[model samples]
Target: MATDHQGPATMLDVAAHAGVSRATVSRVFTAPESVAAATLERVLKAVEDLSYSPNAAARSLRSGRSNTVALLVGDISQPFHSQLAKSVAHVAEDRGYSLLLCDLDHSMDRLQRLLTVLPLQGVDGIMLATGDAIETPGIRAAIDAAEAKGTRVLLGSAQPDSSMALTVSPPFEEIGYLATKHLLAQERWPVALLSGFKGSVVSTLLRAGYLRACLEAGHSEKETMVLDAGFNSTSAQRETAKLLDGAAMPRGIVAANIPIALGAISALADRSLSVPDMVALVACEEVQLAEQLRPGLTTAGTDIGVQGEAMALALIDAIEGQAATARALVPHLTVRESSALS
Candidate 1:
């Protein structure tokens, strides 16, 4: 018996094994409908036997388009990102486009890697949800490179440079403004804002909006209250306890997000402080956990599901070569017993 030697297979190998031309093999992978059934079957069998995968770049070069989109988010575990993923996936599936998820975790280095790999992997467009400012040079270069290639890039949540294509994010500023204004309207003049990370874009906007409302209401700069809780429930809880223990606690609290709101609620409960009696509370995001709590939370936000849907729709439009425009989705305030005074 003679020893057999195998070498790495190529498109030529598949074509030879299938008894077809290299063009036929390429057609079978790129435009299967153009090839006959018998030829297609033979090419597929050869592909499997040789363990040959069509190079996506070559295929895109031939076909002129790739049916895939990339979605980059800050935190995959967060409810808001999870919801957005679901919505974007549904929309992509309906349009016969595939979605590639990339979680940047707010790391510019990670985002840079994604930019390098995404277009090479044949992504037709990109939807970025930075959740915070992305100022790194590498990440900026990647985004610039993708745009230069005519790859549609739609930014969500965080506003990118005006030169780059971006979609509008949820009205985070309005969320803070309305929540604080609502509290002030209810005679909660001294309102304390428990915000997320100091560097977060949403947090900065929300804090600014809160300050604007306070200033408009004739509240002095000295009386304006704010705390940067650093994006953790435990920290918010601890800060809430400390604030309450201070000489003069605010009558109301506006938490930037759901986790912080939950923490604030826990802190209040630990001290046996009744909501809306000792201190009223409102949050930026509405989570089911809030509703299940006693005196259900008064939130100036809508469902994450809605935000996800809007993001998906905008992404699809960008991918389809539609005009890049900002679309702001305002969250409505849902008044509940948590912020109501009896």
Candidate 2:
């Protein structure tokens, strides 16, 4: 085995060492299927002996492709967003691309700037979960600017009515409907919705579905209770505690997400209230530990992994000059002890 002590071994070094032309070495990497078996084996052995690796930057420059994708998300610490990032990265790797994940920290200003900057950095595609920032003019303009630079874009989760890129979104309203309806089926009345921030498109859609279920159950709008719980467990816990302190607590609760459901459960336990015995609980979104709680958390939502895979593939298609279409995933309910009548 020969070690290149002068910086690092180049393709020329590997070509000379392997007794093959530099073109053959390039073909071995770029189109290994086109190379003969013995030649491929010889090149691979030489590459291993010389510790040779392709220069991504040089190849990208030659091919006019960076072989990189960026995923811009709001709060990657959240389980849902983190799951999305993992799923996208897995698919990107399988498709011969690398993923660059960025968190906006729920800041519109940061999102606006990144939307413009990532494309300029030569990312072949971008998948963004813009949250409520999608409504802003600056974000939209930034998205437009990114597209102008030949970077394909994909929008996920909370999208605007008219999307600026290919979108793969879950059926938020259906998730809420199914969660509330499950509680209602359990013979629980006066179900309340513990939703995310008030102005988010996700919250609004969930509220709409909650109200629809209440109405379908012959309950008036006045009978439905909706609480604003921010996007995390802390806010949800605080809000749930306040609700417990108030007069007239609903018999059932539909939480907008897994974090909200966990918070509500914590609040109930702190007050010595038993789940499904005194009050029933359900979450409109799914998480990995949904079934591991004291009483398993029931959820009604699309699989986050599937959603992420779809988003990445759509963006890659758009990047490769193919027309990409928007996708709307339907939600499915998973019943568990939290929402059970017995």
Candidate 3:
């Protein structure tokens, strides 16, 4: 059977090309695990050869679903967000759903606009990986509107709150506490937390953890420092430089994330300061390049993949008309050369 090159290929064309029934082709797209491996392979090959695409509009009409999910993140370029996106996308694909990845670009305005657009576009569900501005009233209004339009929503990096939507995230406060404690255990005094925006939920939680560690060491809140690093490398670098030039220098530093850690490392290098000897450094999350650097990064990290998978499954449960629940993954400290005491 020959498919017309001028128009789009259909399921029947794919079935003819693969020498299978139309139902077999449908099974290949919908429930592939039920099909024989060889038959699945043949149908996939036929789909590739004919460039066959399922008619989404017809499918939507038949199933009353768009079979698509949207993912919103503050910054996809960062290590933690990127890793989470990858894990969510993998799980979404396996569940026979398409993922629409949206970058908020660190803008509340953009997030608001996208919140409106996604429901309008008929995505079955939404997963927001919010790193900042999680408590804005405008965002809550947008989410309410989206839910009113019948789009299920899930919030990543969120705790169990009154809104009652499914939430999945790492234990941010614990990460902060453990990272700071790792430095304190080495007898590094006056440790500082190079953090994200001050008022954001993540920053606040991490600060709480930092304060907890400080108090445990018999240090008051005034004894420790918390600098706003603005959720990026450049800001982190600038703040770190100021800290280094101050009268009372910190013996240990807890960078909020990998990019911030990189920035702090750059600032230390500019001052010709040796890591671990002059100032021990630790990051709240681990990245792939952590170990490859001059000295391996000491980090407090959780399984990003596990968190993402949980988030995806929670959203899917809501999309399928089931009750979803909140989950928080635990974190652990990884000691490395950067935070080692000489």
Q: Which stretches of candidate 1 lie over 4 Å from their true place?
A: 1-63, 324-328
Shift in Å, residue 170, candidate 3: 1.4
Q: How far in Å is the alpha carbon of 243 misplaced in model 1?
A: 1.8
Among residues 3 or more apart in sequence or in different chains, the pairs in candidate 2 whose N, CA or C atoms overlap within 3 Å are none
Q: Candidates 1 and 3: which is better by TM-score?
A: 3
For candidate 1, the clash count comes to 0
Ranking by lDDT: 3, 2, 1
Off by over 4 Å in 3: 1-59, 159-162, 323-328
Clashes of 3: 0
lDDT tens digits, residues 1-342, model 2?
Answer: 354558777888888888989999888765455677688768877876775656535335726778899998878887888888899999899988999988777777666656644654567788877455366778778778778767777778666566664777787888889989988877788798999895688898899899989999999998888999987788898999998888878789999888888899889989998998999999987878787777998889998888888898898888877776655577898888898766
What's the CA RMSD for each of the models?
Answer: 10.1, 12.4, 11.7
Better of 2 and 3 by lDDT: 3
TM-score of each: 0.78, 0.80, 0.80
lDDT per prediction?
0.76, 0.81, 0.82
Q: RMSD, model 2, all Cα superposed?
A: 12.4
lDDT of 1 by residue, 38-68 (tens): 7776876786677564544543553456778
